[model samples]
Target: MAARETTNARTLTIALAQYAQLELSDPSAFDHFCQSVRSICEASARDGKKIDLLAFPEMHLFGTGTAGEDEANQAQLDAAVDIPQSNGGETEFIADSLPARCAELAKELGIWLIPGTFCERNPEGGIYNTAAVFSPSGELSGSYRKICPWRPYERYTPGDSFTVIDIPGKGRLGLTVCYDAWFPELSRQVAWLGADIIVNLVRTTTPDRRQELVLARATAITNQVFVASVNAAAPQGVGQSLLVDPEGEILHDSEGSDEELLIDTIDLDAVSRVRRIGTAGSNRLWEQFRPDDPEIPLPLYEGHIKPLRWQPQQH
Candidate 1:
């Protein structure tokens, strides 16, 4: 990844592989997805604007059209990933592992890659909707599980932690998946923890997509960080794969609901510029408030949530 020079800040070339939603009927279908990514990288190289960070959407394997795990075929879902227990490393992906394959591809293309979320088998014999970022060095740079699954009936277990990875020549890229974007706390947490850019992988459909864009932009302005909010672009998705700058200005927004890959450059140092100028972190409530300080015990959501007599559809 080459350094993209800016006025006084470092820039990064981001390529949003807004992949068409895919139903991984077999392993071959997954391979085809890899081939598509390769072709995109080849095109970039030919154009002489080689990508620094290439990000894909969330749950790209399942196609984002499934009702839930209960309705999805268990066997097919199990075959979608190879979660090697002892394979993942900061500098390497284990043999035959999903992370390994993504890392291999990233190295082949000489670009950092975020291959979106996968079903990771945990040590407890459970599965998690995990997302990983592979470096151009063929290393797994960041790994985060979806802390909040898509409402109820989501099969994967919720993750307990979030992470920010320091990409050499780029910036600290915070990682999250899917519904985590809705909760302000998650983005704020990442921002407070030294994230220059928030990379969220989403596979959203219609009706709720407008809210997704709203949250994406708001998070950027609130945190004063770049937000690479990418979503699946297919029949099952409403592909508004967006890239918002620190000022909450929409840099690249897909007008079409189809496969629209975002290839744009962003200045990572703009985040620091805003923060140092007292317009972002220095002026926020986080800077004034302390966790140890006492506050009113009033709950903004003060009531217990119990299921109603009838459940909502399209969850």
Candidate 2:
């Protein structure tokens, strides 16, 4: 790992890797996943990539649709031990172990890592779709739960709060799960909290969700923050992963079919510049447009409008 360099806040150099395969049901496979990711990080370092942060897609360790579901495979998925705290099982919660492991990995690599979302258990035995972040020091910085879960996700509990974790090198970072990206308010709120960047960890069935990707860039531009979207590659879920800058530029992207590393450098200064200018450039306008602004009313026709096509004549 290299020392942090002083650079433009808007020009944040980010390294993104798209992972293709993950077997969530097999707990033994977790080690292999970890090794594969570490190899990517090591290779990036060797290649002299000035990677301020390294991000991987969602559910890299465990497969999706396996946990908290009523399907028969749920048992296999739950059995995969998440390394509960060794001594009394008191210090380590099964749900917290994934983030803890990620912190250890970050410490080893000495780089900021956006370990994607994982299946987590709440204290009440319910499941939550969550993402954990680790700082360069191998410390568990913070975690974010998917606020708005999609269909079938109702089975998984929604996170009650929004959290932004601060890394020493990077400023505040916000986290949002897959479907949460569809909603602009998630990113907006984080930006309002003064986040410099956002990590959108997600999984989708296919690459056709390009509209959602556009939304991601929009979120970055509107929020005036850097957004690095880490998405899983083929064989596991949809690929077409991307990392977008505060200017809504696609800094790095991976094709939909293969497993590969899409690494790029971003200048963090762009965030500051755009935000300071605070025109349409900054996300401040989002606040200007209120949800309940009486002045901004729904469109209505002052005169009677004819229908495009008349309904069938009634008897």
Candidate 3:
């Protein structure tokens, strides 16, 4: 008699790790950071609560400040690492070491890992803030770049690709970095590419931007995709890590103080249901509005930029 094969329906229990570690300038600091992440994942696993995905904060390994720029951009260069190309044979050499370490960790835990933006050296040797996905099989799944460059990121190169990755029965996953969450258009584009979930790993300093985070939820409803955001706790960004559902419901969140794990069970079927039904509480046609008309430029004139100079003189 031949043995029968069985198919297993896949479901994921995601854990958004909120850490409060101090950002360090020393490259040696990554060892401790890796240890912390491993300990958290392993502890959670031992509790019979296996974390399918662990989302870390943006610039979680190193600090987020720009330093030593006047001297030939050495600060950014110092943090930058050449992925898969570093001369050092140590798998833990440079920033690439973090992702490699996470991959190995994920394989050991049999879970997926999503570490937010790390400095990457491009093929041309220029630096870019990049995010990488590691599979439980210990393989690099997909990598994404921060689309919107804020502050010191103006000099960093932008990525031209929008990739949607498949995660077994979890539907398609979309990747975007820090500032990318600010643009609704980016989320729309990610949705149009058929992603069921859009994950944003961010580092923000302004806590008053709760409205902006709410706007992220609105974007999720409009795009009919679940939004999972992971951010660092204290001394880093706004520190509000959240998970917003396709219906604009806040599934989970964390305040700035606790080094917490906000876990949520995502229903992969909700993507198409909410989009197609568009019934009572799920309308999303507002997404069809276009503002690209040449005549629709802001300020209605040049007054927007130099408003103080262009102000109407005392009448």
On lDDT, the leading prediction is 1
> Considering lDDT, which of the candidate structures 1 and 3 is the better prediction for this target?
1
| Superposed Cα deviation of residue 251, candidate 1 (Å) | 0.4
lDDT per residue for candidate 2 within 1-315, as digits (tens), equals 112244434334576677764665566666876787678777767888656677777766656443445662364337333323223122344444666667677778787777666677666766677777666776556667788887663456788778776555546777888788988867777776767778888677655568778988898877767787777777666777787777687777776647777777665555665554553443444334443434433245343222321111111
Runs in model 2 lying further than 4 Å from the true structure: 1-12, 64-69, 72-97, 278-315
Scored against the true structure, residue 57 in model 3 reaches a CA lDDT of 82
Error of 1 at 124 (Å): 2.1
Off by over 4 Å in 1: 1-8, 64-69, 73-77, 80-93, 278-315
lDDT of 3: 0.68
Candidate 2 lDDT at 287 equals 39
TM-score of each: 0.83, 0.77, 0.77
> What C-alpha lDDT do the candidate models reach, one value each?
0.75, 0.66, 0.68
lDDT by residue (161-230, candidate 1, tens digit) is 9788888666788987878999998987788677889999988876788999999999988887889888
Give candidate 3 regions above 4 Å deviation.
1-10, 21-24, 64-73, 84-96, 152-154, 279-315
- TM-score of candidate 1 relative to the true fold: 0.83
Candidate rank order under lDDT? 1, 3, 2
Root-mean-square deviation (CA) per prediction? 8.1, 10.8, 10.9
- Residue-level lDDT tens digits of model 3 in 1-315: 011122332346788887754455665666776676678777887888778788888767657354444542455556676545222223332444666776777787777887666778776866777887777887777777777877663566887777667787667788887778877868877877778788888776676457667877887877777888887777666677898877778888887656787877666666655655652444745333334423333464443223222211110
Measured on C-alpha atoms, candidate 2 has an lDDT of 0.66
Model 1, 285: alpha-carbon shift in Å? 6.2
